[model samples]
Target chain A: MVNILANPARFLRLAGAVLPWCWAAAAVTGGVGLWLAVFVSPADYQQGDSVRIMYIHVPAAWMALAAYTLVAVFSAVALVWKHPLAHIVAGAAVPLGAGFTAICLVTGMLWGKTSWGTWWVWDARLTSVLVLFFLYLGLIALRGAFDDAERGNRAAALLALVGFVNIPIIKFSVDWWATLHQPASVLRIGGPAIHPSMLWPLLTMAVAFMAYFAALLILSVRAEIAGRKLQALLVAAGRNEPAADGLQGEAR
Target chain B: MTAAVTEFFRMGGYGAYVWPAFAFAALVLGGMAWRVLARLRASEGALDRMRDRAEGGRP
Candidate 1:
């Protein structure tokens, strides 16, 4: 599958084929998740209604980490095998990852204010996630600074790989150090700490967020390809225009 | 029915915090989707114009 999608045409065809289903899944799962989260799920014994924020906050955080993994994996593939589609995907995923990180931070702050009685804290998990957001921004800026697309892609991809060191830090921060953030609940060794009532909604929201990412990522990649085509066309037009404007003879 | 619904929307007095979280997610995701599609449309239009100009100017 990855080998075949190394070809941009094949990738585009697959993306187009899958995009509608992606949208449908995002909508259906998102709807069900929201209903369960807001209406059906019980309020936390301690946090009360504020626990509803967990449905959104946890999924965004998960996606933030997942998106960076997507970037690093795609970047590694791009760097090793010279896959153009992989580069485009990693580049397009940067902004989405950053957006998810932003959601994670904002919702966390809101929840923190109510739960922890502070708006922001330099806890290990929060700080590392902040760094992850910055890495995404750095990749975006580094790519834009280059004049050539290929150079930009490779430079950004390499930076993404280097920035992946932050991922493990973010994942383990709540564990390796004492932090305001709670330890892993759902994916821990002894099984989920959360009750099934909260757990089901959280899992549904996770599925919704993943589907959302798929739909958005495919759309963004399509747009990025179109933007590249436009740039190539404009460059070709500029090169051909002078020759046809009767300046061809003077050059010769 | 209406009172119960309104109470639910109140989010047990945490509406201020709860509503905004979902709102931010919608705003960011919706805004990005809008921008992506708009740019794609504009680029396709520009490419078409360039192609048309090239063909017409050939004669």
Candidate 2:
């Protein structure tokens, strides 16, 4: 099992096979989730329609942290076990993670302003999340800085591991410190405090976001694998020999 | 039908914020998808051309 997963070609083939189902899952869940959040669910008695933002905000917030954890785990694999696909997975996921964090912050700002009358705050939860976004940006920049691919991958993976301390900070921020942000409504020691009417849509959107991430990750990883193959071909061509073997079926 | 449509569009007077929130989500996800597909296609094109050239540029 370990060897099977450690091989890049097998992983790439697996990603291709799983890609279509992931897209289908994302579309179905996203469509249904949006419908439930917008039309089927009742409005909050107090916050009113502004609560609609939760559908987008909550899922994005979930993904923001989740993606970083993924990066951290993959980075660990690359650094410790030298898994071939680990660094590629970590590097390719940065932009998507950054995007999710951006959505979370922006939607949070919108919700905050509508509810708390403030667009910006120095609260621990918000600040830590902002730091997470910047951490992703830094890894991306660090990866592109090195001319040698191995050195670049090593540096980025190391940074990913070092920066993983922020994930716990972001998750527990609302609890560890007093903040304007709400705390532990769904994923808590006890079951969800939210009503079923609201919880169902939120869960649906969460599934949609996870599906979206899976689909995007596979596509991005496939691109990364193809990119490395292209690079290998280029290097081989420098030796005045054919490099067509690596190019076969890679276009698909 | 008209009233229901209007109400839905209104989003209970939070239309400005609500609409933009969803729009941003769409933009982020959609933009990422577009970028990834472009990368895949570009790699595919380069690989195909290189392989063809290596095969004596045969059709």
Candidate 3:
């Protein structure tokens, strides 16, 4: 499994076969999930219609943390095993992770404004997620900072591993502190605290988001692989003909 | 029919907050999808062109 995953050509072929199914799953599940959320689910007794926001908010928040953990794990593998594809996967994940984090934060704010009567807060859960957003930004900037691509990948990998401490902080912050954000309702030590009517839709949406993430992650990794191949080809061409060697070296 | 549609959109008086939240999530996710597709297309195109160049510009 590791060998197949580590081989880019094989990985690409596997991804090609799986991509269509992923897109189909995402579309089907997302449509059903939306229907359930918008039309089928009952309004919360306390939060009322604003509770509808939970469908989007909870899934986005879950994806945000999940994506970052993926990055950190891939980054670790890339550093320890020096697998180039692992770095590519990690790099592909950063933007999507950041996107999810942004969605979570913004939707949280909107939900908060309705329920909490405030747009901003300095609570630990909120603050930690904000830090997570910046960590993603820092990794992106670091990845592109160095002219040497390998150096940049290594630097970004290091940053990803170092910043992983915040993951637990974000997960536990609600329980650890008194925050406006609710505690983990679906994924907790005890069974999900949520009602079944709402739970099914939320779970479906989570599946849809994950499928979407997988499809996009595959696409981004393929693009990064192609980009790397193009660079390698340019370098090889320069090597065959010594006349343009200086120019190619300078170009790089 | 129209009343039901309006009520759905209104989201029972929290429409302002609810709609924007969902809309922003759509925008971000949709934008990422667009960008990822563009990147894949551009990179594959470049690779094809480079391969053609290696083959002495032969199609």
Q: After superposing candidate 1 on the true structure, give the runs of residues whose Cα lies further than 4 Å from its correct spot.
A: A241-252, B51-59
Could you tell which candidate, 1 or 3, scores higher by DockQ?
3
Model 1's chain B yields a TM-score of 0.77
Q: Write out the backbone clash pairs for model 2.
A: none
Lowest lDDT sum, 10 consecutive residues, model 3 chain A, at A242-251
lDDT at position A222, candidate 1 = 83
Ranking by TM-score: 2, 3, 1
TM-score of 3: 0.93
DockQ of all candidate complexes? 0.53, 0.60, 0.64
Model 3 chain B: which ten-residue window has the lowest total lDDT? B50-59
Name the better of 1 and 2 by lDDT: 2
Which candidate leads the pack in TM-score? 2
Instruction: Kindly report the fnat of each predicted structure, to 2 decimals.
Output: 0.57, 0.69, 0.87
Pairs clashing in candidate 1?
Answer: none
Docking class of 1: medium
Candidates 2 and 3 compared by TM-score, better number: 2
By lDDT, the best candidate is 3
TM-scores, all models, native as reference: 0.91, 0.94, 0.93
